[model samples]
Target: MADDGLDPRRWAALALLCAANFMVILDSQIVLLALPSIERDLGFSGGGAQWVLSAYLLGFGGLMLLGGRTADLVGRRRTFLAGTTLFLVSSLLCGFAWTGGVLVGARVAQGISAALMAPSALSVVTAMFAEGTERNKALAIWSSVGGFGATAALLVGGTLTDALGWPWVFFLNVPVAMVLLALGPVLLSESRGRARAYDPVGALTVTLAVSAAVYGVVRAPETGWTSASTLGALGVAVVAGAVFVRVETRSAAPLVPLQIFRSRRLTGGNLVMLLTAVGAFGTSLAVSQYAQGVLGYSPLEFGLATAVLPVMAVVGSYAAQAMIGRVDVRPVAMTGMAFMAAGCLALGQVSENSGYVTGLLPGLFLFGLGLGSSAVAAAVAALSGATERDSGLASGLNTAAFQLGGALGVAVASTVAVSRAGAVPGFRAAFDTSAGIALAGVAIAGLLLARPRRRRVPEPVGVTMSKEESTCGT
Candidate 1:
């Protein structure tokens, strides 16, 4: 496409990228279904078991900026290949892990690999497809794949854990990733951004800051909020964040150029995405636990009960794509967030005796629709006007927002749940919290996203406007 001579079949390459992305996202959810089983077999107790999930989130979210920057500096193709390979290896290790510590370590490796692969994959798609209708369709399909990954995990996890045991969930990725790797070299094209010196200080400080902050949040429930360990980690995060800001301002080649914030559309989009994630991710954890641990549904039944989400999500994704050319993303995203908040509020009303048919199904349907719609619009907003050079960074920032929001959401929801009365009551409390966060997102979308500009401002000759600056009228 663009005379790159690397991937002549652009759509085929896109399929490969989406598949790899699906593999990574699927791992994140599949583990949720298997968590109870993992606890029983591996002798994990209380919050320690959360490390299996948190360890992955920590590495993935913390290193995302560096991963995205690296994709820009090194070739996207090279980084994708290396990252996918590492993911495959780590998945294999996770399958064979004998202890909680080993599994968590392997999961951390998987997260790091994903940080590299996910952003590069999205950037490559942007490079391959031209902007406008074609790009919108590609992104819609990309987001739908993510929805499928998240929902399909419940079904696949239940089937695997029931039939072949929990280890098979991890083992399943090997073959899928292997097939992707085999096809990657043949179908994918290579691309890179402007050459610049690496900013090691900025990268190191930012990663540490994110890791420390996530750790402090995750541990705050077990250790009191004011505990020395919690406060110390949070303090480290604050200092490191300050250092990272200083490094970026001074460095000739910054890991993340502060100028990116000049784009109001991107900044607002990321904020909405972060807030939406707080609702969606936490709801998933709370609901899954309720279905299995409280309701006493077997793994397979749990899958069947929640299977409606992905199906509705597909409908919403296609609907979003159809509306993209005609409607501004601001309204679309706002409506989506409103639906999410409504769904969470409805689900939060659940009682111990509430059954799947009356209590869960209605809210699940709404949540899925909102999830698909919000994901499509948020992704479009985040990447709306990026130039070729900064596409990878923009993609990385969007993904990092989602990951970090998820980690924080889970921590907050779990903490609230732990402090509440019983399992069901605690879950309801968490759902209420999720709804509140989604409402906050609605406020942001309403205030921050300007109505789309109807008329274009003329520029002087030889002074061309970059797409990033012009698209959102920022």
Candidate 2:
């Protein structure tokens, strides 16, 4: 309602935005299957290797809230274009990177671009599509692209990594970027929110603090908890975080508006998002290692093993498509959460030597099925009440939560694995822990996402508004 001026061009622009989101998500997974090769080629150790993912998460998650707000403050179209440019340039750098450090740095750059672009894309969609059936369909497709993109990344990444080498994973993003950039400027119209002060201090403090903490967690696998590097990083994270909170409270422009946290839907939905992210991250990262290390598969083989996960995701998304108006989003999300928990449990118990035929494949399929449905439900549920003004913030916050959950999952699981001292027992323990976390995620959703149903009816508009506003505000 805030920006009632909807243009017919918006539809084409949203399609392009979804395409861009697909590319960004693809990069998230494309290099994952190739990580082993890259590690061998670059000589990175276990903890050191995680930086490949952690660095990207750090940049993407760290600045995400600020980036989204920047889109609101500036013009969404310009921000989207700028982010695409950055992503393209960074991907080229990543492809060319010779050293582990160079690659990690480039990954950071790519994450920054993702942080900037994704929220704008989501926010643009929110502005373009009117609420109700049309918006639900659009968000469904938007969310599904993310799931499908991850799936495509596996196939594409495997082919590229096998045929052209791991660097090609990054290189692949360049042409896609160019295409999005060209299509975007021609198609997208400039859109802005209420002008607000830019919170440089708050943004920097929060980003650096989170980055430090994530670094500590990611590097913990390599650097012992007692190591100076880990301790110092955590300390920096603490100090920076404290300062960030203080800055946001006093600053005229806050990267995250404290008031938005007041809503139960916003807070609860974010918790669900964060947990789901952890569940999703742990599933993907751990699965690859389990597939190759335990099951004796190659990178391409491992990638193929995951094909079912994405496939299931698409199925789940389609399922949600049919249910949008027929159901409220909470129960749908809860069902998806239940599936994810079940999948995690199945995976945890799966025999180490199990092939896709006997063990891994079934679990992977379950994960895919569960994840696909859950992701769509979460996006819609989270954005249920999003308005044009706050869409960027809400989208950004959800994204930030997801990214942070991913980083946290890897960090925690790796720490557990390392604490087990890299033995078979340790790996098993780590997988068990991952499954437990997923259960915890399921429990959280069961409690928060479902219980709110009692409150949904008396205030349908309020509930819906909560979802919409939460998407924008969070």
lDDT, candidate 1, 146-241, per-residue tens:
877867787898899989999999999899889878998888878888888899999999999998988887788778778999999999999999
List model 2 lDDT by residue over 284-323, tens digit each: 7677667777778777776676777877888888787668
Misplaced by over 4 Å in model 1 are 2-8, 45-47, 451-465, 468-474
TM-score of the candidate numbered 1? 0.93
For model 2 the TM-score comes to 0.88
List RMSD in Å for every model shown: 2.7, 4.0
Residue range with the least summed lDDT across 10 consecutive positions in model 2? 455-464
lDDT of each: 0.82, 0.76
lDDT of 1: 0.82
Candidate 2's C-alpha runs over 4 A off are 1-6, 40-49, 225-228, 418-427, 450-474
Q: Could you tell me how far off, in angstroms, the CA of residue 371 lies in candidate 1 after the best superposition?
A: 0.6
